[model samples]
Target: MQSKDLLQLAEQFGSPLYVYDAEKIKSQYNRLTKAFSKVEKLRINYAMKALSNVAILELLRDMGSGLDTVSIQEVLLGLHAGYSPEKIFYTPNGVSLEEIEEVNAMGVQINIDNLSILEQFGAKHPNVPVCIRINPHVMAGGNTNISVGHIDSKFGISIHQLPHLVRIVENTKMNIVGIHMHTGSDILDIEVFLYAAEILFDAARNFKNLEFLDFGSGFKVPYKKDDIETDIEELGKKLSKRFNAFCTEYGKELTLIFEPGKFLVSEAGQFLVKVNVIKQTTSTVFAGIDSGFNHLIRPMLYGSQHHIENISNPKGKERFYSVVGYICETDTFANNRRIPEIKEGDILSFRNAGAYCYSMASNYNSRYKPAEVLWLEGQGHLIRAHETFEDLIKNQISLPLPAKV
Candidate 1:
């Protein structure tokens, strides 16, 4: 979207809003699919936890994408967005057996990670088809907090525990239809990912009823100009060839699946917040905004870098300013960053806000969450409205205090 278009959105929908470009999202989805066109059967499941707006879910669903959900609520959201139960893949971590059974009863594909739940669930519903999440023990990704396939990570069943997993599967007489793994986010090395895929393939040999192999996605997208990103085309070419060969060896044409969250929508999103104040300290100039960590916490939580641009004064002289938020705590988006001159009431755009931005927002400090807009075909459509005061107290029970002495 143009800077003028973004400015208009801020004016019409109010500040501290999220604007998503539908064209960008479609381009990304097409890019991934075209890269792997060689694969006979492939499934791209949009990870709903990254950004679970119903409109966004529907948008992806219309693009022939399935839903990769981690919770029952997300599964329900997918259903509400018009996704069939067969297209929804439920892969929860550390959830109760009751929740698993509930989702199973809904007819969505179930992926179990731990051994205990596998045994319990399989023993109860051996007739139900299930998927197994295996930890390849490969350390891939940019940070420890995001990586899950490491040896010590508590995400999936360890590769070393293959014997145990096989034993449980055999004892319960359960059908394993899929094998999956996710190394982490911000993965730049295709070779490391491919090596992990080899480990997953070896584990797949333990199950003869497998219908698909899910190489869980962590394909990194560029955060800033000229930043390095995953080479999906090259990775696709290499993996598709190897996958076809593996299918031949296994004596069946297995489906290749990927569960991608950020790669599909990160570049499509822009978070716009109006500058509220400018304060000059002894050592730094702070450009405080109307929003805070309550809206976008990736920076404070993950040290993420979201390129800030002064859309209000895009051609103005560049200056150094530390972008902070109105949160009561230490909420900093960028420190000593160079951007066009910013002024009070000027709208600033946070790029790469499409994934994990709005989904992670909260009502922290009793602040209202911002609205969300989708830019489709050169027009802005409001997807979520800004919170009102009544929304804050909707579920609260107000009782008169007892008279004090």
Candidate 2:
């Protein structure tokens, strides 16, 4: 979107709003599908946890994308968004067996990660088709907090425990229809992912009833200017060839699945926060904004870098300013960053806010979450309204205090 367009959105939707470009999302989905067009049976499941707006879910559903959900609530949201049970895959971590059984009863595809749950669930419902999440013990991602396939990560069943996993499967007489592995977010190396796929393939050989192999997505998107991203085209070409050969060896064609979140929508999102104050300290110039980590916490939590642009004054002279937030904490978004001159009330657009931005927002400091807008066909549509004081107290029970008790 153009600077003027973003400025208009802020003016209309109010400051500290999330603006998503629908065309950019569609273009990304199309790019992925076209890259892997050679795959006979391919499934792209949109990871709902990254950005779980019902409207966004509907958009992905209309694109023929399946849902990759991690919780029962997300599964229900997907259903509400018009996704069939068959198209929704529920893969939860460290959750209760009851929750698993509940989702299973809902007819969503169940993917078990730990051995205990696998044994318990398989013993109870051996007739139900299930998927197994395996940890390839490969470290792949931008940070330790995001990586899950490492040896010590508590995400999936370790590859070293294959013999035990096979024993449990055999004892329960359960049907394993899929195998999955997720190395976490911001993965830039296709070779590492392919190597992990080899591990998944080896595991798949253990189950004759396998119908799909989910190579969970962490394909990195560019966060800054000239930043390197995952080579999806090359990876697609190489993996498609290898996958077809594997299908031939297995004597059956299985669906190749990917659950991507950031890659699909990161570039499409822009978080617009209006500048509240420009304070000059002894050593630094702080450009405080109306929002805080409560609105966009990737920087404080994951050390993420979201390119900030002065959309209000794009052509102004460049200067260095540290972007902070209104929260009563060290909620720094950027430090000593060079950008167009920013003044009080100037709107700054933070790029790459599409994924994990709104989904991770919190009501810290009792602040109202900003509104969200979807831009489709050159027009802005209000997908979510800004929170009001009533919303903050909507669920609270306001009982009168006992006299001086």
- lDDT computed for candidate 1: 0.96
lDDT of 2 by residue, 1-405 (tens): 898999999999898999999999999999999989999999999998989999999999999999999999999999999999999999999999999999999999999999999999999999999999999999999999999999999999999999999999999999899999999889988999999999999999999999999999999999998999999999999999999999999999999999999999999999999999999989999999999999999999999999999998898999999999999999999999998999999999999999999999989999999999999999999999999999999999988978975
Once fitted onto the true fold, the runs of candidate 1 whose alpha carbons sit more than 4 angstroms away are 403-405
Alpha-carbon RMSD, candidate 2: 0.9
RMSD each, Å: 0.9, 0.9
**lDDT of model 1 at residue 369?**
93
lDDT of 1 at 2: 97
Q: How do the predictions measure up, each by TM-score?
A: 0.99, 0.99
The CA lDDT of each predicted structure is 0.96, 0.95
Per-residue lDDT tens digits of candidate 1, residues 256-364? 9999999999999999999999999999999999999999999998999999999999999999999999999999999999999999999999999999999999999
Clashes of 1: 0
lDDT, model 1, position 141: 88
